[model samples]
Target chain A: AAGVIQSPRHLIKEKRETATLKCYPIPRHDTVYWYQQGPGQDPQFLISFYEKMQSDKGSIPDRFSAQQFSDYHSELNMSSLELGDSALYFCASSPMGTRADTQYFGPGTRLTVL
Target chain B: DQQVKQNSPSLSVQEGRISILNCDYTNSMFDYFLWYKKYPAEGPTFLISISSIKDKNEDGRFTVFLNKSAKHLSLHIVPSQPGDSAVYFCAAVTSYGKLTFGQGTILTVHP
Candidate 1:
């Protein structure tokens, strides 16, 4: 019954400002993923973390960065946000290192960059 | 280069009828597939999954069929209900757990 958890359920920021989103993976889950969902679009992979290290980054801009702490909590930071950055950010977690593992998603953080 | 593709943007079906949502993938390396359902403002929830080794997987009213040869997969919801209305996404895993998702298909089951 473990599920992913994200904070700051909704955020509004001006362009050129900074935004940070947090995610806590289920206990014992080893992989954490970040995705961005545009309005009426499917989720797009942003980045992933495994074993407290960045495993992979999707085709995201350099302004976006992510970190995973010792407790498997991950933070995605966007510096100098743009209006295009406005989207629902989702955090997901899966067991171990396999890609076939089922991922559990958190109620996403809706970011609106004005 | 969209590896996963959901050609249909939306589908409508009467309640108690069968609803079929289709997805196609261009990546032959994909070994696992999954379907997810999402409401208006919530994150997607897992609905069903199938491995490349299997042709079909079923649970309750939902069934997923995978055709490895054609690089296609489909989700069938039997006796669809109003509550079954949501956006459905098809995802493929080529590497371990990282997924490539297709544009979702919005399904509306009318009463």
Candidate 2:
């Protein structure tokens, strides 16, 4: 079974710069979710999309934006990157249905803002 | 305020013994509960989940029990092996698929 795919398994950026992270969800999955896990902390929900539409939002920062493309893949855009933004970014996908709640996660992208 | 909490930070079990991890939630609206196992530098792997309608769900060597009235859930791993050592996270979801995770509990099964 194909799992979710994330680009740039590891990233290093400087403060005040910009970065974009991409996620290719499992084939045929309709919903994509983004989460951030800070050092020593649990994963926090950032945002989610269903059918390419923004479905829910969580603690995502105002400087960050995300969208799901027609291909069911999603991208998270961050600007004016801050050192605090450094964390593990994860993407998860699920099919639309009663079992859609069960999300399959991708190996996270480790973002290090220098 | 943390809606989901795993009070224990770590647990140790002898191989072949049973390991139990507990989680508590304050949100009454949460209807679905899930447990995930995570290794360092990797994404969480889904273990088992139990819906509010079901009191218990079992798989292979893992089982999840839900007590709706107590707003508590627990994951049980029987015949624990050293390979099972890792972090376990408890997550809850309402009608929406958005997950609220609990601080993970590290479990070490000694061989």
Best by lDDT: 2
Interface RMSD of 2: 1.4
| Model 2 clashing residue pairs (backbone) | none
Q: In order, what DockQ does each candidate have?
A: 0.73, 0.71
lDDT of residue B102 for candidate 2: 98
Model 1 lDDT tens row, B50-101: 9999999999999999989899999999989999999999999877777889
lDDT of each structure?
A: 0.91, 0.94
User: What is candidate 2's CAPRI-style docking category based on DockQ?
Assistant: medium
Where does candidate 1 clash, by residue pair? A98-B97, A99-B96, A99-B97
The true-versus-predicted C-alpha distance at residue A92 of model 1, in Å, is 0.0
Error of 2 at A58 (Å): 0.5
lDDT of 2 by residue, A1-114 (tens): 799999989999999999999999999999999999999899999999999999999999999999999999999999999999999999999998845347999999999999
* Cα lDDT for residue A113, candidate 1: 89
Candidate 2 TM-score to native: 0.98
Instruction: Provide TM-scores for the models.
Output: 0.96, 0.98
TM-score of 1: 0.96
lDDT of 1: 0.91
How high is the lDDT of residue A89 in model 2?
Answer: 100
